[model samples]
Structures are given as C-alpha cells and as structure tokens.
Target: MNERSPVRICILALPETSASVVYGMYDMFMSAGRDWGLIVEGTPGRAPIAPLVVSRHGGAFIAGNNVRITADAPLDACDDADVVCVPELLVPPGEPLAGRFDDEIACLRRCHAKGKILATACSGAILLAEAGLLDGLDATTHWAYCDFMSRQYPSIRVRAHRALVASGDGERLIMAGGGTSWLDLALYLIARLAGIETAMQTARINLVDWHDVGQQPFARLARTRQAEDAVIARCQSWIAEHYAQPSPVGAMMQMSGLPERSFKRRFQQATGMSPLAYVHTLRLEEAKQMLETDRQPIEAIANEVGYEDAGFFSRLFRRKVSLTPAQYRRRFGAMRDAIGCISETR
Candidate 1:
C-alpha cells in the first residue's frame, strides 16, 4: 500500500489589515503545491472545478471593484489544516485585536493541540504570542518591536538579529518580522514542506534571493588589517573594546603612536566613518541590544552605554530609532505580553 502525503495549509485573515502578506503566502504555497504534484489537474470524469482559496468573511471584499474575494468558510475550517498561517494585523491601543481575536486564538490552540504547524508574519506574531505558544521559546519579530517583545514576555528568549523565529520542537510555531519578511517565511515553509528545489523555483519565479536561516537581513562592516595599517587596526580594535568608556581621540592616537592628523585620516578611510561617530554608532548598537534584552532601568541602560546622563541617552536613542527609551520599552513590553499570552495558552 502507498503512504499518504500530509500537507494541507490554511491561512487565517484579519479584516482591515494588510492583505499583501496573505496574497504572497498563498502564491508561494500554490506554486509549490503545483510543483510538488499536490494539486493535480482534474480529469474529464471528475466533478466541476472549484476555487482553492476560501476567505473567512462571507462577502467579497471589493476595493473600488479592482480586487474581489469572497470568503468560503469560518475559523472552524482550520481544524483539518496541517499548517495554519496568520498574517500581520494593525494592533490598536487598549484593545486585544480586532476581527476575531478570540476565535483566532481558539483556532491556533486547536491546530497546535492536533500537532499542526502554526506560522505568523509581522505583527501577526502578537496573535501567536497571545495564544500562549511562544513561552520559553527563542523568537524574534520586527527589530522595531524587539524591545517590546522581550519585556512583555520574559519567559520567551527573544533575539533581535534576525527576521524570522521558529519556536517549539520541530519548529511547530514560527514568526516572521515586519515588511517583506513574509516572502522569506513563505519560502522557508516551502523549503520545509515541499523541497529545496520547489523553494528555489519559487524564488526564481518571484525574483527574490533564496536566503537561508543563517543569513541576516543586515550587513556587517568588514574588518581587514594590513601589515602597513597595523596601528590603525589596533586603534579600531581598541575602540571596539572600550566602546563603553569615553576614550578620546588623543588616547587612541597615543595608543597607536601616530600623530592626530594621520590617525584621524587613517581611521576614517578604514572605517568610512569619523572616529567619534563610529564609537557613537557602536555604543548606540550596544545600547539597542541592552534595551531589547535587559530589563534594566533607563538610567542604568544609559550608564552602561557610556551616557552619563539619561537625557543624553534618550536623545541619542531618539536620533537613531525615532523613539525614546520609554517608548521603546513600552513597545517591547507589548510584544512581550503578546508572547506571554501565546506561551500560557500553549
């Protein structure tokens, strides 16, 4: 007897949220499904053709008659799905989530209880976290919300370096960061569910780089030390090592045994940024990490990042992130809560 294949996907949609993620996910899955022989052509003797996608809401959502879609079923349809996807939603203040939060949570729990894969994209991670599935798991969301995720859900280990996070054994729960990361998540799912070939084909069709989980969205500056530029390299290393300390330019020049003009020119040419600017950038990056991972007070965070005054830290953080320390913490706190909710329910 032949073994049966088990791969069924069902994506849940929230009203009034971004639909691009859903469409993108659907396209990737459908393409992969065709490639994997999951969706076969109908025979002449078979019943009439039917639509594969079914919306949650009943009526067709027509935006100026340009786009139209009619929902086929409700959240209960998720029970038979092997994988369930939730797209990003615009969260409002003082409200859990609009458009079937409780129902979505129940559906997620049901799916997980039956060993189905649960995936979320962008702010949709909040839904999974609220469902209690992300507790004590290594997860990440959009970098902008990393701090909020950490504070709200202290049990879950949050990392800010990546665009996607998979939690639980066998990667049963996964979350993708904001923006176009939905594409990455869909490709990841395709690679796992179908095969690498299908994922590669899909990537080719979409003209997207098929990135591996190990790759980061951001590029790191390269550090190359030549024999002639030993002093400059050493000074750069010192700056990296003593970023938290207020090491003046004079100190760097003295350490390198080079004159001020030479040191300044060499450092700028090597690093592409002024010496003090580079130091400030490093400190700010460190401060960002501290803000996301640590639960320390604002003043402590400022001091740890070499800011003598909390106000200065706030100003720098704002300049870099367009958000103050308090605002950053609040955002991460919300994310943490969302994650905590998911963990508890799970």
Candidate 2:
C-alpha cells in the first residue's frame, strides 16, 4: 500500500500448476523492478513489486510438468499481499474442487473479504470459481474450458470471447483470457499497481505483444466430441474432405444408406449440429485458414469454400468468426506475414 515500499505479490502454487506461468510471472515481475535499469538507457527507479511464491503447504513441490519449485512461505505464514495471483492449474474442467483445494479456497475467501484483488489465469479461474468469488461476476478462462466452466458454475457470467475481464468494486478481481494471454494480466497488474511506465518497460523488456483477437477466432468448431456411431464417423470424414462440393448434405444422406429422417437424427446426435450447419462450419473453418495464410481475394476464398455468393459468405463469416474475412486477414494474416518476414531476414 505504501508507494515507497514494494508492492507484495503472493503467487499461489497448487498441485499440477503450470510451472511456466509461475516462474514466468515471478521472473517478469522481478525483472521489472530489478533489471529494467540494466536494460534501459536511463534508469528510472527500482521496480515496485516484491513477489513471493507461496503454497498451501510451503516447501518444494513438483508442478505440472515435474518442474520442482520451492515456496518462499506457506499461505498461512504469509501476510495479506497487495495482489494474490492464481496461476494456471492444469486440473481438468468439471472436476470437483472441494476435496483438492478446500484450504486454498478458504484462504482466497478470507483474502477477498479483506479486499485483496484476486486474479486468475486460464484454468486458475477454477480455483476462484471453487471459492465462489466469481459468482454473478463476468469471468473468463481458457477458451476450451469456457463452456465447461460456465456449465459448472452457472451463477458466473463467463465471457470466453474477451481477452480479459476485471469486475467488482475497485475491480478487486481480474480474469485474463486463458493460455499465454496471462501476460496480459501481468502487464495490467504492473500498470495498475506500479504505474504505466513500469508496465511499458516490463512489456518492452519481455517482448510481450498484445494479442488483438479474442479466443473466438482460434476455436475449432468441428473439433467437437464425435459420436461412436461408425456410420456417422464415415459421414463426418467424407464431409470434412468434400465440404467445398455442392449438395454435401444430400450426398452424405445417401452415403449413410439410411432414410433421410434417420440420417438427420444420427448426424445431429453425432456432431450436435445439423448436417447443413456442419457443412457450413467446415466451409467457414477452411475460409478462415485461407484468410489467415493466403493472399487470395475474399470472393475467391468464398468460392473455394463453396459459397457462390461472396456477400453471403461475408455475412456468415462475420456471424461465426465475429470478424469479416478481410478483418480477420488484417488482424491475423498481416501480423503473421510480418513475423515471417522478420524471421526470414534474421
């Protein structure tokens, strides 16, 4: 709380926690306060935050990938920190959290009651949800786990589409978009607590780039759980290969050798989408890939994906991707091309 004293950051280390995230945050924050001066021409001042790794039981423990790290202190031993950061826990979605993290949950609840801003990255939101801190608040996690988290915690308003969400009074809680975007949380916490200059210096020092697109663009719609029905499997495979061809649904129905009604029922049961919608999803995914990787014109991409009407394709692309094809290209493709050019020159 004191401007002159370092902001105390307590990072909780749980079983199966991502070692990269834990060490990454610790290193980045330390570098911000300790190494910024060495890297920059004119040093301002020492970094503001003092970070410590704390566990439920303080000691050396193995993280998700068997990377062992020792805690500076146990949660019970540590004082209330300025910020309590929850790193990505590699727990499966929809698993019960009561037995595994009851103590951690209690600690978090007490911390929140005392008004410590609780932040979670990726699946670490699981801990916050388990603690019931996120109820009635907008939150997000790894896009793959968004639906699972939403279904498990119906009271929490989950926004899998956004990159980061900070809610509650004084924004005491923050949820970064899942995965590597946790760096966004790091940058934000620095700016909020340490000042913008420190945050910018940290970003520049770490080469952390802001991701413009949300998780929606990267979702693989067709990568859903497939049904056990062998007929439906074949139908799905055929559709994946021939989605650009006209009359795919009709062809699939005939291939199934079932009555139209039977084929439709089985297909829907298998993929959780209508046959026509599946074709559209396939086409849209292909279109997105081309838009991100190729220089083809929008109309050409549309036709290649089986849309004769580029206007219709544009509308569908927007509806599904939340970005027009050209917008997607500009957002993803141009950056990728620029990165490629840089790499080639290097």
Of candidate 1, the 10-residue stretch with the lowest lDDT total is 43-52
Per-model C-alpha lDDT, please?
0.67, 0.84
Clashes of each: 17, 1
TM-score of each: 0.55, 0.79
User: What value of lDDT does candidate 1 attain over all alpha carbons?
Assistant: 0.67
Q: For residues 1-346, could you state the per-residue lDDT of candidate 1 as single tens digits?
A: 0125536677776664465666667767766635333333432211111113334544456421244545556667777777888877665312345455777787788889899888887767777777778888988776545545665666878765567778897888988876678888888887887667767766776787633432222312333332246777787777766878776566787898878888888877655457787777777767766666668998998898788988987887776555677776676656776898899998
Model 2: worst 10 consecutive residues (lDDT sum): 218-227
Query: Pairs clashing in candidate 2?
Result: 33-47
* RMSD from true fold, candidate 2: 4.2
